[model samples]
Target chain A: MIKARVTVTLKNGVLDPQGKAIENSLGSLGFKGVGSVRQGKVFDVSLDVKDEATAKHDIESMCEKLLANTVIEDYQVEIV
Target chain B: MIKARVTVTLKNGVLDPQGKAIENSLGSLGFKGVGSVRQGKVFDVSLDVKDEATAKHDIESMCEKLLANTVIEDYQVEIV
Candidate 1:
């Protein structure tokens, strides 16, 4: 089996409202030193395929098609 | 400045509906080899402080208090 990991994050120009909320929450919680925060998503995927190359390619396509919004977000896939 | 990256994931034995949804989605998309998928959250935190030790300690406490729900989730804090 191959383990594929994917991380989905917002684009540079995109406004992250969730991140902004976290920043405010941290400040309110007395963590004044925390500056801006950008939050993202992580996926731990286990594939039944044994070939690493096939898993990597499939997962990359998965990220492009559904795991991430290509227009506003970027995704990185790693097969282990 | 210190960059603290936090990854929050559900503890073992917890039911992950989102993960299950992803798994089903992949299967529906014709990716039949996809077994199980676990989804988690990532926080890219920027600290205004310069000292690494202080930032690490503060971020650890921050994770415990707000960044993650220690009761059902596990969090890993990294100071860079």
Candidate 2:
């Protein structure tokens, strides 16, 4: 079994209200000197397939087709 | 300046409804042989702090206090 970790993050210049809220909250909590906070998604998938190359390709395809909205977000796949 | 990427994931044995939904969606989209899908959170934080040691300590504190619930979730911080 191969496990793939996918991280999907919003592209630069996109408005992230949740991240902003978290930033503000951190400020309130006395965490100073914090610049920008961008919140994203993480997907941990276990595959029954064995080949590393095939797993990487399939997961990337998954990210492109369904997991991430390529117009607004970028995804990186790490196989472990 | 330092950038910290924090990944927060649920502990094993915890029920992840969102992950389950995504898994089902993938099956509907004709992607088979997928075993388990676990969903998590990603936070991209930019800090104005200079010292690597302070940055690491501060970020870990931030994760414990706000970014993740340690009782059910585990978080890893990566400095990049």
Candidate 3:
């Protein structure tokens, strides 16, 4: 089996209200020096495939097709 | 400035409905050889602090106080 991780994050120009909320909350909690908190999603996937190259390719396709919304988000896939 | 990435994932034995949904969807999309899929959260945080040690300590506190639920999830912090 091939193990992989996919991280999906909002595009730079996209607005992230959730991240903003976290930033504000952190300030209220007295954690000083915090700035620009961007939240994203991570997926840990175990594939039945055995090779690294094929695992990477399949995971990328998964990101494009279902894992990420290409219009507003960007995704990175890594085989571990 | 110090930049860090925090990854929070559900601990073993926790049920992840969203992950199950994604796994099923991937199967429907005809991406074969897929196994268990676990979903998690990632935070890309930039701190105004200059040192890595202090940054790591503060980020850990943030994770404990807000970023993660200690009862059901585990978190890893990395300085980048």
Candidate 4:
């Protein structure tokens, strides 16, 4: 079995309201050094896959098809 | 300048409602292989530090002070 990690984040031109909200909250909590927050999603997946190539293919398909919204989000995957 | 990565995830005991929502959404999108989804946060920070020790201290302070909710989350950091 292999462990796969996937990260999804908003595209550069997109606005992230959730990230802004967190930034505001952090400032209110006395975190004065914080400048901004860009929230993203992380996933840890366990797969019964054999090699890195096949796993990458399957994971990329997963990200493109369902895990991320290609219009406003970008994704990266790491297998270990 | 150095780059630091901070990842925060739900404590093992806590329930992750957002993760469940994403899982359901993926299933609806026809991703048959997806079994579960656990959501986490990642922060990429650029710092003007010279060494790893100070960076580690400052980053850990950031995590404890603002980046993560210690009551419900655990965090890990990587300096690059």
Candidate 5:
């Protein structure tokens, strides 16, 4: 068994409302030093593949197909 | 300047619909080895501060105040 981890985040040019909301919430809670917040997603996946090559191939397809929205988000994958 | 990174994830009990959808998408893409996906969040924050102690304190405050929902998500912070 292998572990495939993927992280997805909004592209640099995209607006992140969820992150902004969190930033606003922080100010109200008295954390005055915060300037901004950017939110991203992480996925820890378990795979039952036999070798590294197959694992990489499958994971890449997974990321491209479902783990990220190519239009607005970017993704990175790590195998362990 | 110091860098603070925070990772937030749903507690073990919460349902992760985004992850589930990704898993299904992977299966349809012909990557049958995938079993489960647990989704999490990551935040990279930059702060102008001195000393590890103060940075830790402020980062903790940020996590508790805005980075995590507390009710459904847990968080961890790294200072660099």
Candidate 6:
């Protein structure tokens, strides 16, 4: 079995309201010197595949098909 | 300027409905050999603090206070 981690993040130019909310909340809670709180998603998947190459390929395909919204979010797949 | 990444994941044995939904969706989408689709949150934060120790400390505090639910989720903080 192979393990892979997929991280999906918003595009640089996209506005992240959730992140903005967190930043404001942090400030209200007295955490200073903090800025640019961008939120993203992580997926830890266990694969029954054999090789690293196949695992990466399948995971990338999964991101493209279902895991990530390619229009505004970018995804990175790493085999661990 | 310092940069940090905080990853929050459900603790073992915690119920993760969103993850289960994704797992089932993956199977429905024709991705085979996939199991244990655990989902999580990632926060990319930029800090105006100096030094790694202070940054790490502050980030950890953020996790404890806001980013994670201490009862059910575990968070990892890294200065990157």
Candidates' lDDT values, in order?
A: 0.89, 0.93, 0.95, 0.77, 0.81, 0.94
Give TM-scores for every candidate, taking all chains together and pairing residue i with residue i.
Answer: 0.95, 0.97, 0.98, 0.76, 0.83, 0.98
**Cand. 6 Cα-lDDT:** 0.94
Model 1 DockQ (Cα-based)? 0.88
Q: In candidate 4, what are the lDDT values of residues A14-71, reduced to their tens digit?
A: 9988868766776676544555567787887655566778778877887888778999
- Tens digit of lDDT per residue, candidate 3, span B17-47? 9999999999999999999899999999999
1 or 6: which has the higher lDDT? 6
Q: Per-residue lDDT tens digits of candidate 3, residues A10-60?
A: 999899999999999999999899988999999999999878998999999
Ranking by DockQ: 6, 3, 2, 1, 5, 4
- What is the per-residue lDDT of model 1 for residues B1-80, given as tens digits with 9 covering 90 to 100? 78988889999999999999999999999997888999999998999886988888888898899889998999988875
lDDT of 6 by residue, A16-44 (tens): 99999999999999999997799999999
| TM-score between candidate 3 and the true structure | 0.98
What local lDDT score does residue A46 receive in model 2, on the 0 to 100 scale?
90
Full ranking by lDDT: 3, 6, 2, 1, 5, 4
Query: For model 5, how does the per-residue alpha-carbon lDDT over B1-80 read when each residue is reduced to its tens digit?
Result: 67777888799979999888877877777778788888899986666667767878898877776678999999888875
Clash count for each candidate, listed in order shown: 0, 0, 0, 0, 0, 0
Candidate 6, residues B12-53, lDDT tens digits: the string is 999999999999999999999997899999999999998999
Query: For residues A12-59, what per-residue lDDT tens digits would candidate 5 score against the true structure?
Result: 979998878877777788765666677888888988989877888887
Clashes of 2: 0
Chain B TM-score, candidates in order:
0.93, 0.96, 0.97, 0.93, 0.92, 0.97
- Model 5: how far is B53 from its true place, Å? 3.5
Q: Of models 1 and 3, which has the larger TM-score?
A: 3
Docking class of 6: high
**Which residue runs does candidate 4 get wrong by more than 4 Å?**
A11-38, A48-52
